[model samples]
Target: MNAGHQTTRRLAAGAGKSICRSCRDSLSRNYASAAAAAVQTEDHVSQHIPPVAQASPQTSYQVNAGVVLSRPPQITRDLHPFESAFFLYQRRLNERSALPFTRYFYYKERTPADREWKRKIKQRLTPARDIGRYKGYGEEAWNDEVLVGAKESDFNWQVERLLEDAETTGVEDQPAQELTETTPSPLAQKKVEHEAVERPMSRITEADKKNDVKSLNRLLQRTLYFLVKNKEGQWMFPQDGLQKETLKEAAHRVLEYSAGVNMNTWIVGNVPIGHYQLDYPTSRKTESGLNELGLKTFFMKARIMAGQANLKENQFGLQDFQWLAKEEVKTQVEDKYWRSIKNMLAER
Candidate 1:
């Protein structure tokens, strides 16, 4: 009975081992078939694949460097009406709160200078507190001038007229013309003449008056830019194609080549301040002998410190030029071009 049981156990163990071996063989065959199918699919795809197409003449945008040359404000801006009134009020307030004139310190006691100063002050100026107390306004009022007084309600005149009426009579303020008996001494007269007033030049220039757009002297208080009309009769900033140089170097060349080498301009930096991508259908040929589909323009900032543009050479094939303010530039150029460079201009 024991021998029979051992034989039965051996047979069962052999059958289980044979079954495990068959399952392993089937898995290996399935994996091998799948790999072969994948290889065949890859070969079919490779046979059907198309050749890579080459780039045409206009594979990309043509790199261009544009210069935004500007003349900064030459003078301070004019004060608006409200600004003027505010400044006037501030000056008056300061004058009102100021310390009284130290007569003894500024002038000697009872000397000719002191006597002249006293006479002048009494002749010209009247105290605001002492005004209207008496009808007489002293000797300051002239025969032809109207009699003036500061009133409590201030109804005799508006602020536009008779402002600070008691401050100065604006008469006989000049040094005595003749060196007669009542005139100041020779030394005093000489001193007065020595400190004679000098009038300042007007802010408005002849260029502004004549509306000369070429002159740099116009628009003293606003930034003025350089614009030129191209052969197409469109106004734009001076620009040129890049070649074997950095963006800033290209800008300097553009300014010199287009605007002329006479200008004393300094580019602000190596990096561009603004960029404009234009789809310009250009007939101009590139080094590749192919037409450029468009231009990728990078704008660099430059300031004109001294000299002006020399458009006489016409090296850039320009039609006309102008030095105009930002608003004027917007009016001259196309709307799309204006939108691209609008923020690059100085607000002042």
Candidate 2:
């Protein structure tokens, strides 16, 4: 009976070992299958991911979201006319200020027809004929005269009149000067002679010259406009301001200054990226904020022209002040950049 019991126990132990071996094999197969499936998933992700260029639209959308939030439509619209006038006036004023007396005199000596045309322009706000209809003057020349001659007061008066007429008539009526074709009167000739006589007998003082240059410069700078295109690509100017010539100089100065500082890459092709990665991070802390670096630079340039070195330096944190204060990093950078520009211009 003892020998039979031992045989049965041995058979039972052998069967138990075989069952354990089969269970271990099944577990190993399941783990291998799971690892293989995970690798396949990883490979699929690597193959399907978009390249940088292809994802540009998404990137653009992200960047523009910030711009849309910070910039109001009215701000852009209001600045356009001011910037255009600023640049236009600056150029003309600079040219006039730089010329020899004889050359300037020759330029002012218009022919009989030219005087008549100018009289017609002064008599009416509306230009009756197309710019091309004028014999000697092209679009550029005509625009220059109209801009330079029409001061801020003149524009204000014209706009006021237009608004008044619009309110009264329920529509704006075109000025009648466009329909009138009057020859230059004797009074116009006499006025021209009087202006010629009033021309400075000696070279203008430095201060006066600087003032004239600044006036025109400011006008041109103020005239710059920002426009947006709709889906159809039609651009509309929405701002109103003085247009001056100095704005071009300011823009050139900015580009040149930026290039000198090894910032040309930022200015040219990669503004959105640079703004996101570099500028946006710093913009959140201040009142004027981070996006105003370009505008700050423009203002600094204007201040320099205005002969307000102390104020200009203060804006850049170059001015020494008592006590502790949080200094703007960009102001410091721009201050250094502009100093380098001044040095370079001096060398030239």
Best-performing candidate as measured by lDDT: 1
> 1-348 in candidate 1: lDDT tens per residue?
333345445555777656565565565566666667888999999999977888774556788899999999989997775555454445444434432556677679878767655555545353232222222234632222213332322322223133433333322354454333445476435433322333456778999999999999998999999999988899999988899999988988888878777888899988999988888665566777777678888999999999877777867788889999998999999988899999999888
lDDT of 1: 0.71
Cα-based TM-score, every candidate: 0.66, 0.17
Question: Candidate 2: misplaced stretches above 4 Å?
Answer: 1-316, 320-348
Candidate 1, which segments miss by more than 4 Å at Cα?
A: 1-58, 99-102, 105-116, 126-196, 281-291
How far residue 41's Cα lies from its native spot in candidate 2, in Å, is 12
**Least well predicted 10-residue stretch by lDDT in candidate 2:** 64-73
- Taking the tens digit of each residue's C-alpha lDDT, what string does model 2 give over 168-192? 3211222334223332344323322
* Cα lDDT, model 2, residue 295: 16
What is the C-alpha local distance difference test score of each model?
0.71, 0.31
